[model samples]
Target: MGISPELRSLNLSNNHLEGPLTVSSIPLQLQSLDLSVNELNGPLLLDIPIPEQNFSLEKLLLADNKIEGPITASLGTMTSLYILDLSNNQLRGNIPDSLGNLTLLTVLRLESNHLNGEIPACLTNLSELVMLNLASNELEGQIPKELGNLAGLASLHLEKNNLQGLLPLSLAQLSNLQVIDVGENNLTGNIPSWIGTCSSLLVLMMRSNNFKGKLPPQIGELTELLILDLSSNLLYGEIPNTYLNLAAMVVVNEDMSVVGEDRHAPSARRVRPCGAPSGARSRHPPNIRGITPDSDHNYYGTCVDYVYGNEDRRYYIEGLDLITKGSERHYAYVLSGMACIDLSNNRLWGHLPAKIGNLKGLMFLNLSRNSFNGDIPGSMGNLSQLESLDLSLNKFSGKIPFQLGSLDYLGYLNMSYNNLSGVIPQQGSHMITFDKSAFWGNPNLRGCPVESWKCSPPHSPLSPPTIDVKEEAKEGFSWYELSMGWSVAAGFFAVVLVLTFKVNWRKTTFDQMDRAITFLLGERTN
Candidate 1:
């Protein structure tokens, strides 16, 4: 009796098959074989000792098993193997280079194993290899330059490894490449200037690498490039202007141009495209002219520039320009290392800028009564020397920046009568004191006031009444003597009023109107 010569498919999956695979019992014409996700154990010993020339397997899967030991050189004997999955196994040792000789193999997977050592560079010779993923392993060394020859390659992921060195410019050779992730590695040097020139390159991520130097000025050319992450690298200098000026990111101060920090003065530090965390001073020349702490820039120098064209004036006011250049009365005492800028009780509006903390030399700052809003910038807390800050009677709000505690010298803080919230920064640092009055009228405020004011917190008047010291003094003038004379003259008018009312109590409306109109019109006519 002659047996039929037809064989098609076989599935031996999840059967807990153990020990050596009996390849000799597999059907000769088998097109598919599956033995995956099983309890199979022991070394992947080829049961048949067939020679390479006589191999006939087309598809084979022995994944997710306890199969161990090295892939023998005999794996090269399966010349006709097209689809092979030996993933999720305990396989160890070097991959046989002879397997690269298989010309007809299209799909191959050997991931999730104890694979070690350098990836075979000879494998890049596989002209038909596609969709390569060798992630999550102990693989090392540099990626082969010949990988640029994979003409049909589209997506490649070689992330999370110990790969190093500069990417070969030949990578620009893969015309069909789109999604590439060589991230989380030790890749270094400047990004290829021509990378933005690729027409199909969409998602390029080289984050968490040693990429150094400026981002190419032409990166804006990548209009289609989305999700570009160049973080965790050494790239520095001003953020590229071209990379900015795009609508892709919703960020503040995103314009990476050699842009001035405040957009007005080169005097401000050169903030780069990538943001520096707060209080991060740029080493870019220190903007020597930029006002900073521990420097004599804010004081101790002859006035090179004054707030008003003439700070020469000893006393000043917004209502009048009083230039008391050399007046003896102009002198006022200011303690050394103590700060007092009285840009207060003015018609000023707008929020207090956090930059105020730059006054590391400040022992006092009284913005006491301006119309500033917004929470204090946390940067203020960096002022270790800030002993006194009075932000009273303004419209400032939100929790006082917690960083306030860092003000080791901050002995007095007053946020009274404004809208503020949360606990006052209670590090009790330099915290000399405050009373309910110090933080009065700020319905959102809670917690104990600074120590000193508990006895009698200042009352919350409906509003902070502005007292003009000069005006108050003027009111005390003996000018009251002049008013007394007017008072006596006023007594004379008091008698006149009684006589007129009693004598002409019944005067008519037309008579009075006619009399006034006649007198005024007569004078006009004359």
Candidate 2:
């Protein structure tokens, strides 16, 4: 068996082994041991000189186990230790700085534990250290920028800590660095350009801080980069055109203005921290102010690179800051594809662009608390895939376009607190579930007004006249004109009657005329 005198390595990972683990066996030729990802319990109580028995350890990993108790300072007894991983357990107490005495250690990982206190500055003296991860712990104080002196460092993770102050300017010296994550901390100051020049760098996360200033333009040159996130910072300046080519989706509250097709700039709004605001759960892209959710986007446009500081959603980009400018003119932020973008509580301005339909894949779109104006674009109907859309607290005007009803996937809609008028688009699932609160403050909006409100009923369409007088007259004259014809006929009969009566009067008058001559003088006198 390999457990014999000439045996070299031992591996026992991903098993259900539990209980105490003691090294009391006679075998001493082992050089490496891996007992990770198990339910093993109890403290490491190796008292014997395991190293002196020819079992000089070059690597020792005991992660994802139920190991407890403080790291014994006696760990330094393994003077030849080169790699050590004791992560993913309930290990408590401060890290034993004496472990630094293992001058040969090149890799050290003690993450996901209850370890507390300031990181031992003596760690800087480990000139041979290559990989270090102490994330998701209770560490405090400023980051040791001196660690940048480790030119050989390839990966580092110090997130979820209380580290503060500006990132060290010397980090750019890490030419061999590939991955770095310092999010969920209190770090500040402008992102250094030198860090962007790390040629071999790939992944970087520095969201959730007071860091300000423009992103470095040179960072676009990182061809091997796969992920980067610098969201939720107090950064400013337009997003560099080079940054548009990256392919990632940041899961942080990094805020920036989508100034144009290729131009992005920093915003002034406060990005959500690693956590969320009160009464609101932390959502993807962190806790923003003016942004809302849009889901069920049937529009599947191109996928663009998202540079932010949060992890997850498959993409991340660095080299952009949002805090310096606050929330001025950050609207028209478009990253094609049917994705979710929550930009709440920002200082963005301008009407929503018509091209917004280009994001056929958008399911969630929130542009609340912004300075947008103008009629909601009719083209929005093309976004048949949208779910929840919030354009609330804006200065928009005109009737809410009916095209919104085409979005059968619509769930929650908040056009409230805006100058919007006309009927709120009535189609979608949220229509019945929502009430006046969803369209409040839109004075001209047509609908059954709330009982307490006194808005008038909507105007009705007019009915057309029954007959075209001119067309009817061409076929048959008016009744008054026909009556005129009858009047003429009656006039002819009256004329004939008058003529017959006149003959009688003429005969009498002729007889009277003879006597009239004689009586004319008397009649004239009478």
lDDT tens digits, residues 217-323, model 2? 77666643434556556655444545433322222223422112221222211111112221222222212223332321111111112122231111111121122
Per-residue C-alpha lDDT of model 1 across residues 1-526, encoded as one tens digit per residue: 3324564456788876777665565666665678888877777667456573365676678878888888766676677765577877888887778777765554466766777677687667666654455544557788888877776554466666778888878777776554466767888888888776664443465766887776676655654333344544666543354543222221122122221233122221111111122233222211122234332222210111111122211111001011111111211111112222233343345655555554343343555555667787787775565555677888888987777766655556677888888877654432325445667778877655633333222343654433435565687745446667899999989877776786564355447888999999999999
In order, candidate lDDTs are 0.55, 0.60
Taking all chains together, each candidate's TM-score versus the true structure is 0.44, 0.51
Q: Per-residue error at 507 for model 2, in Å? A: 95
Q: Please report how far candidate 2 places residue 132 from its true position, in Å.
A: 1.2
Q: Give me the runs in candidate 1 sitting further than 4 Å from their true place.
A: 1-7, 11-22, 47-56, 217-227, 237-526
Q: Evaluate model 1: give its lDDT.
A: 0.55
